[model samples]
Target chain A: MREEPSQQIDRRAIRVWQLNGVVTTLVFAIITATLYIVKGQYNWPDFVSYITYGLAALTSIYLLVAIFVVPYIKWRRWRYQIYPHEIYVQRGLIIITRTVVPISRVQHVDTEQGPFLRAFKLSTVSVSTAATTHQIPALPVEEAEQLRDDIARLAGVDDDDE
Target chain B: MMNEMRHVHKLTIILYVFQGIKASAWSLIVLLFLGAGSDLNQLLNLPFTSFQLTLIILGVFLLVLIVFSWLRWYRMTYQLVNDSITIKHGVFIRHDRTIHKRRIHSINFTQSIFHQVFNLTEVQIETAGSDLEVDAVLKAIPYQEAVALKEKFLNLTNTHLVEEELPIDGEVEAVDEEQVEEEQPIIKEKKISIYHLLIAGATTGRVGAIFGIVFLLLSEIDNFLSEGDYERVVDWVSAQSIVAYFSLVFLYLLIVIIIGMIGYVNRYGRFSITRESEMLYIERGLIEKKSLSIPVSRIQAVLFKQNLFRMPFSLGAVSVELAGGEKDDKEAMQTVIFPLLRKKEWANFLKELLPEYQEDLSEMNHIPRKSFTFKALRMTIIYFVGLGVVHYFYSELVLVKLGVYLFALLGLYLLHRIPAFRRSGEQLVMQYFQVVMLSKEVAIVKKKDIQALETQGSRLARRLKLGYLNLSIMNNFLGRQFTLGFLSEEQLEEISEWYISGHHD
Candidate 1:
């Protein structure tokens, strides 16, 4: 109970999470179908198709829930707070982890864009520490840069290259 | 420089020869594995006997290795002069590295079992801020010489240390201790009771290993089974089924605990931490003894850790974060103060070890709600992957499936125990629930220790008024980073302002 409790990440980020979920489902479905069709031509055992079909059912259920049910929950859960002295992050619905990064300890701050995030006109701010790297994924591009600058400003890192 | 280039102990030749043999043997093994030496005639497309040529080539390679080893041994020399240590070594190209005495954080004297047989020990020195690198390693020095070098490197001479050196190491004649009273009698903690050591050992990793061996034996149970053995087992099972099941389980538990106890007792035998002057000396190990000396100032951090069972009993372990050590090298006793300590005992222990470490914050606050949600995604990913892998391996095992489900419950419970941080001026204080054992760890680090600080955000987190912040302090090559997510936007801005505002001057 060291860091103060705080808020969630941008709600719009869930749309990207949803999109990611759907893309994964599509990819999984495509791979399974291609494998089944190719293996079918080689007179594969009939039971093998049954296994693939069972897998398809499981993947569908998983992806469907991920795309439909998870995005909102994820949006609601992502939260962080920063004080003059320390930065606090707590996220994770399943195995919740909370990290407290002291402002005085920050080394570098930057923003990153993935293909999907770029399409959505979004960027993710990345914070680097000696041991591990932290990311705040899915902010509008300008906002992401601003956040990076703000963190760099706070951490007193003058070599700001954003 | 030429006049000062003195030869090392003559035994270095023997050390080099052994090393050369080990290297050449590994290379030969690799060549054989690659099938390059299977049939020399076939490999070389030769007309005459290739077996003799292959033998000749191998002999030549071995000879070259020996020559190179000898040259390396001959060239390797170190000197302690001008308040610095310089080690100059290399066969083809020369390397002369000198480190000033002030930067020398630690000088450890070590002796492997083989070295002990030869009455030789190695002295390794580490300069400050050089991660994973030793300033100099003077190998195969006599024990007395190594001790003297350690003292001269640090400019300390204590006869008490000499008297205490090589405890129970049969051959070293006991030194007269009449003047030992002149030095402050080195403080020694009570030797850990065998009972507590046994308890701690059972709770260590050995229990898991014992269970693994038991399960492996069970998998091979069919190999021991014949028709008569099966019939006898069935007859006993039918006669006293419930009693037999309980007895078997009890026997299994007993065996695992015994195995763990044996391992811990053997390894941590005569575990002792003694403070003499400005350094802490750790002496442990049953068979091949190890004695090490670490200066107090070189300690970076203290980690108070507890496994799942230990937490319930308030019996946690503490390991010091050393500033410089080689990567993945297991100097177990050096890192550990002791394997088991009651929660009530930590304050006194830390007071003895690190007087500068203290934390007191005037006010505190909780992390924002989004912190949990954002981190939940990361945690869920690990659990999901773990479950998927376990399911793939043991889909039909109902017990294993139940265990996986049980782990999920544990995971959820852990998620609820996310850590928080507090800071007062220059020091950051944090208390977090470490996933391993659901143990709570409170860490206090100074602002000056921090190497980096940063904050990041995904679009959705920003929408939900969330951000991720991470900061690190230099400890090892990879600094220790602490992260907490889902802070409000206002908090992030305030933090940024505070961090950058005062540092400009």
Candidate 2:
């Protein structure tokens, strides 16, 4: 088997993911509350009330897993490395995917940061080739910028038509 | 050398009129058939009778179309300035697009019957851009003038190639057509004979598709015809005797086959491929003559395809994925280089046409046999679980369950037998089946053209040492991925290693 990539994403990625999970859990909480409201307003059958209870239970379970479990495992699994000629990325929770993108084939590189990522002082480095784009997400802001610039410089050294 | 803007031939107006009618044909049909003679006529309270009203509407629509076409034809113009072509178009927006000769990938000339009547041809210029439309088009130009422009553009592109010092293959010399005009001999040529066209049409495997389309059209016809009329037509059909019914069935089959043959012959009647210098020229079509010129370097990948109907006869076709062109016109981007070639002749065909991809495909490594059982089990688990749920709802569908099971087994068997892969130096050859009918596709793509390589494995697959390999190549603005599943880890590792390091240990 090939060796695993040497680098991991920023440690703060877990917290960011948990924050996202909290927002999703909030949405689920609203849905469960709405179902409860509808059942009472319409004098719905016992089955409706039972469905609401089932949804509430599922939501609570999801809240615990998403905030407490999934992010950490996801962050732990994400690994990447920058070789002289190619970029190696391995990521996934259950179905692991390893991608190798040659620097020569790269069309461009970019650093992007959403509001949450910006709040955490993190950014995503997206390397685009002619056919596909691979992102190394949740890197420190400065590191992401440096990585983008490095990839851009390396990609410029080779020229070919798409 | 013409720097001044020039409009297309005046015939473009007439062509645009036909185009406008074609674009709004469905609305016209509804207006005429459903509205004119129906309650809509009384609701409108027009001065004339329904028949006169319909005539007036048709007349007004025709007049509008003629006026609009004239305006459009008058507004669009093209010019050649230095090494670039500029098209000034749009009836209101006045859009101007300039494409350099260096970016030109191919130029196609199409002569429709109308254009033939006027001794004009339509010139479509394609560039290596991500535009959904051909970069530029001269709707109608004198045939001789278009040919001269094509040569000039090709020569300019060749001059740019020389300046760039690209690694053109030694055999495919990028010579200046201007200098070699006297001695530009055809290096190789192939033509499809009438007998081959008959075979190609018979094995096209489009009969099922055509039957479906015909039935769909008949179903749509119910909307126009009243229920009584529809019943009468059905009764007339059912009223035939057994002998008449048999003859009717025979006639239908004959008509379907004849329709298929006519379509195939019309599209590829005089099909011919010619190679000269660094370009491959394809000329085909009967009613509408089409000729295309593609440079050798622009070919992204080569595909050998065998449909289910043709597989039994060992017949297949060769197609190539070009780097850039309009995707709306399916033929523009992925072109069939050869319409028909026997299995044994494939290597020879590739050697003669695309020598860079010529390789011994016989030595490919098949996927591990054990992986078949794993995949088949996975498919069965998912399908049967769904089937069991369906059985709970529709318990009497035992025959349906059997049919589904048999179909799934056949699919698994075909999937298990087909997949093969090989990595030879710069080229990676992958053979697999697609399109739900076990139509075999063998694709050869260069490593340099591949934008990314991905290997994926689920937990179960990881334990079994099986994985999937996907290679992405540029198709228009997006990447098109070709995937091979159930490959052993060793095969994946060796391929990935070769891709990453450009060599194997």
Query: B74-153 in candidate 2: lDDT tens per residue?
Result: 99988988778899888878889998877887789999999999899999898887776647888999999898788778
Task: Give me the runs in candidate 1 sitting further than 4 Å from their true place.
Answer: A1-162, B1-71, B129-135, B155-191, B209-263, B276-278, B326-334, B358-411, B414-429, B436-440, B452-471, B483-505
Candidate 1 chain B, poorest ten consecutive residues by summed lDDT: B325-334
Note the Cα lDDT for every prediction shown.
0.67, 0.84
Prediction 2 TM-score vs. true = 0.86
User: Ten consecutive residues with minimal summed lDDT in candidate 1 chain A?
Assistant: A1-10
| lDDT tens digits, residue span B1-505, model 1 | 1226566666777777777778678778676556554477686676656556656667887788778777887999877674566788889899898887667766766566767888887667767655444557776778887777667656353452444444565533434344445445546454577777888887775477688998898778867899789778768767886878899889988888887788778777778777766677777766555666677665655666666778778787766666555232353322776778886787667666554664443244556665666666766777668868977887787677667666866675565455566666656655566553455655556555555455556656656676656656555455665555455666665554444444434
True contacts kept of each: 0.24, 0.92
DockQ of each: 0.14, 0.63
